[model samples]
Target: MARKYQRANRMNWLMPVLFALPLLCLAGAALLLWGDQLRDLINIAVKLAVIS
Candidate 1:
């Protein structure tokens, strides 16, 4: 009974990490593909802020 409880507790934390790994990979891939575009957007926003 105690072992089952321990296993369940371990899985509770592990589950979220397992779920997040794929999402993190996808985000990394997106950044790699569009990093230049993101940088341009940020620069544009900064310039607009300075102008205002």
Candidate 2:
């Protein structure tokens, strides 16, 4: 009985995060897809020089 109670306690804390993972992933994907359009952003430029 004591072990069961402890397991439930752990799951109570963990369950919400497990359930929210998919929504978090979806939000991240949406942000990546539309973030530039929604804000002013710049791409980094790389410089290369040829050795003489």
Candidate 3:
């Protein structure tokens, strides 16, 4: 019973990570696809900050 509980506990923590992995992969792919736009936004933000 203790061993089964331990296994369940381990899976509880792991399940969310398993579910999030695909979402993380999609986010990474999106970043890669729009990296140039992200960089441009960062540059604009920096320029505005410096101006202020």
Top candidate by TM-score: 1
Candidates' C-alpha lDDT:
0.93, 0.75, 0.93
lDDT, candidate 2, equals: 0.75
What tens digits encode model 1's per-residue C-alpha lDDT throughout 9-51? 8888788889999999999999999989999999999998896
Cα error, residue 19 of model 1, in Å, equals 1.4
Better of 2 and 3 by lDDT: 3
> How well is each residue in 1-52 modelled by candidate 3, as lDDT tens digits?
9999999888887888899999999999999999899999999999988965
Tell me how far the alpha carbon of residue 44 in candidate 1 is from the true structure, in angstroms, after superposition.
Answer: 1.4
What's the true lDDT of residue 5 in model 2?
A: 94
Better of 1 and 3 by TM-score: 1
User: What TM-score, computed on C-alpha atoms, does each candidate reach?
Assistant: 0.57, 0.48, 0.53
* Full-model lDDT, candidate 3: 0.93
State in Å the error of residue 45, model 1.
Answer: 1.8
When sorted by TM-score, best at the front, the candidate numbers are 1, 3, 2
Q: Candidate 1 — what's its lDDT?
A: 0.93
**What does candidate 2 score on TM?**
0.48
